[model samples]
Target: MEVVQVLHMNGGEGDFSYASNSLLQWKVISMTKPIVEEAINNLYCSSFPTSLTVADLGCSSGPNALMAVSELIKAVEIIRQKLKKKPIEYQVLLNDLPGNDFNTIFKSLPNFLKNLRREIGGDVGPCLFTGVPASFYGRLFPKKSVHFVHSSYSLHWLSKVPEGLEENKRNIYMTDNSPTSVVKAYYNQFQQDFSLFLKCRAQELVDGGCMILTLLGRRSQNPASKECSYIWELLGLALNDLVDQGIIEEEKLESFHIPKYMPSPTEIRIEVAKEGSFVIDSIRVSEVDWKVSNNNEVNKAKSVDESLKGSGYNVAKYMRAVAEPILISHFGEEIMDELFIRYREIIADRMAKETTQFFNVTVSLTKPK
Candidate 1:
């Protein structure tokens, strides 16, 4: 499968678009705010550039894209205010897959610029923003052109599905029941993808340039940790249900798999060390526990059924925005409504019994002088 073709958030301002259901991503931006600040601060402390070029890799459309850029510019302004230096010109690049919704991104730029002007008036210099349509697996900028790089919740996606993965007949990603070959295939793919990622950035980033990446990762050394594995497992289960009901073919489930892998902290460290492009500045693992969009209403509900239904409805919508395009590509667009109806029921039922959380691994690295 061509990731460039199938991998993009649902587009348009419609109810099912990623623009409509990205609160979870927004929350992730909020969680990684400090790391963003820290990276910007490091950039400032390392011979602050008179004119800086910053890139946000895999910056998907929606509120979160601008939010990340806003925080970055805020960091720069804060440093300038303290030192009382001349205004610094900035060139900001928003990058995503070629098929990304660049139109929606451009549509919101005027307001973003207007709001930006409100925040840091005359004190800051002129700013230029451009959308770069491409993947980050290779060089996207000139050598030593970028001062800092930031990515969030995007690196977990592999450049391509791992080879030799056909053995995992029942799983979407590495799961408790996944064979050792499946686990090895995923791990090897991650190593290749991440090393290429670092190498590309190493060439693009100036010496001492800092890069901060926040991605879905596992806390436990085990590949099957629920923190990162359960969602796909549950989705696989939903697909299985469709198969049992004869709504979809069994072969579709066998061939269809999510192109995401959640790496462990140890795996990350090992790969970073072997790549030998940058030095690790800081790496942190944080847990984000699942919660219904509105707990107040959930508690107010009189029946357990209502609460579960509500929880599942919101989550299913959220997941659908991000996952719909891929599912539609393989399974056909006709079954999306039905597929997610069952998905929501499964999620709600699971949530009612237990709380789920995802581990976000944030790493700040700097190119050596």
Candidate 2:
């Protein structure tokens, strides 16, 4: 039998799109910037090189990539100013899937450089900006060429959907009420994708190089019951609801699946250890309060109600509007509205009471000596 490829916004193109929205979350960005800066400082200090080569894996097209790279440049400039030494040349690499929207990123580059020029006031050192489109799971650059690698909100995504999610196969993940096949299937896929990611990243980093990864993670090893607890399940249910309502055909709904996985901190540690190329430097966990829109309670409630009523395509418009092009490409326009309504109900009814809506784990790893 032929294998079916499930495409959802997870690791490849979707990672970048999701990141675009995530970057707008000022609270999250503010908390993450310092950690990233500290990691860069540590790498620079340990390496003791005047020039630095940095790469942002899974960097999507838009201000987010520029924002991250700019922050790194600023951090390095501050260090140089304090030392009274000339700023060193910086090579910044922005990487994403081949299907990523580099046009948007490329268009914004000139503006970013202009802003940099103004900020440095003719004192800025050499900087090279390059766009690389490729999967992070494989070699994108020459071996040992990268000095610092930074990835945020990207690692949780799996390279591909787990094998054996077909109707006949037994699930590999666990469930709250029972050891159902559904949970088992998810667990198996998560393990495979995560392992491959570690192996690939290990080959890319040079000995002593540092990698700082920040992504959504789970605190508990136990399985969750509600579909909203997992992004993929939430999306699946929404699509199912659309099919049931005759908004979309069953064929289209059947083709949808989340391509990523969210793992616990312990699982991450275990996977990294298996690679045998990196040592854990530090692990920091923080709450990530992600809100779809403005935090105004009245407005939020109103939107929620509108979404559930399937009024004015508000539900589908909200999700599809924010969704990456890759997903839109797969699902097309037919299911958009239904998906929105289903998603709204899931969020309002299931996720509203939860305080720990989302959590981020920042793991700093250094290539082994």
Candidate 3:
């Protein structure tokens, strides 16, 4: 599948929209707030530009879209207040693939600005927001134009599905049973994509500029480890179930593969060294419970089984919001409801057997002067 054309989160304000199901992403942003704040402060102190340029690559639609940008503006404001510096202008760039729901973000822009102005009062400076619809795998900005960059819950997605996965049939991603060739193919693809990402960002960011990236990752170097690949494995099983029911062709299931890779910290460090553009300031690996976003529903449940069911449904919904578009692109929309229903059941059963969590790797990098 052409990931660039199909790899967008579920859009709109519906029950399954990314806007509604992105609490986990919000948790990621919150977890890395200190890293983002420190990076922005250091960048600002290095050379406080009267007009600053900031870009949030992969700033998918929803409340989380302007979230990091808002925090950044506040960080700059705090520093300015401390130094009694002159108010500054901000050129905020929200970038994502063309397939993303930029309209949702655009519509909410006015209210976002209004709230910011209200909070900052008369000290508020001009904050210009522009939506840049393009892939971040390549150049999206002019040279040395961006001062600060942030991306959350993105970058794990490869530019496209890796080639030579024909042997990876009956599975959508690297699984324990995947052949060594399939695992190697996925890793090779991630290396190439990540290197390109760093090179392009290096060109766009000015010297001393910094970036914070938070994405799905695994603790182990093993690409097929359960921590990173189990979610996709469950998805593959759901697809296979449909195939067994004859609702979807087995050939179609065999051909489909998610264009994503959850790299290990070792892999990330290696890729950064190979790219030779930016130096890693800090990197951390953290785990978030699978029910992180569904805690409220689970808490309200009257029984253990009900809580488990809620957690599973919550997870299934969020996963659907993120993965449904690509699935629909390849398998068609007719199978979505059924697929997720079975998926939720499978997830509930799995959670009953073991605790599940998503591993996240957040790294901060700086362009050396």
Among these predictions, the greatest TM-score belongs to 3
Candidate 3 Cα errors over 4 Å, as ranges:
none
lDDT of 1 by residue, 1-369 (tens): 787788999888787888887877788889889888987987886786789898999999988878888889988888887888778898999999987898998899999888887887666787798899988998899999999899998999988888887878856677888899888888888889999999999999998898989998988888777889998888888888888999888877788778888887778889889989999888889887655343356667789889778777777887898888888888999888988999988998999899877788888898998
| Per-model TM against the reference | 0.96, 0.81, 0.98
Instruction: Please state the error at residue 117 of candidate 3 in Å.
Output: 2.1
Candidate 2 lDDT, tens digit per residue, 144-246? 7888888876666567655554552111122244235555766777777767766776776777788888876667675453322454455556666766778
Model 2 alpha-carbon miss at residue 166, Å: 2.5
RMSD of each: 1.6, 4.8, 1.0
Please, what is the whole-model Cα lDDT of each candidate in the order they appear?
A: 0.85, 0.63, 0.92
Which candidate order results from sorting by TM-score in descending order? Answer: 3, 1, 2
Q: Looking at candidate 3, what is the lDDT of residue 355?
A: 85
Can you give the lDDT of residue 140 in candidate 3? 96
Two-way TM-score contest, 1 vs 3, winner: 3
TM-score of 2: 0.81
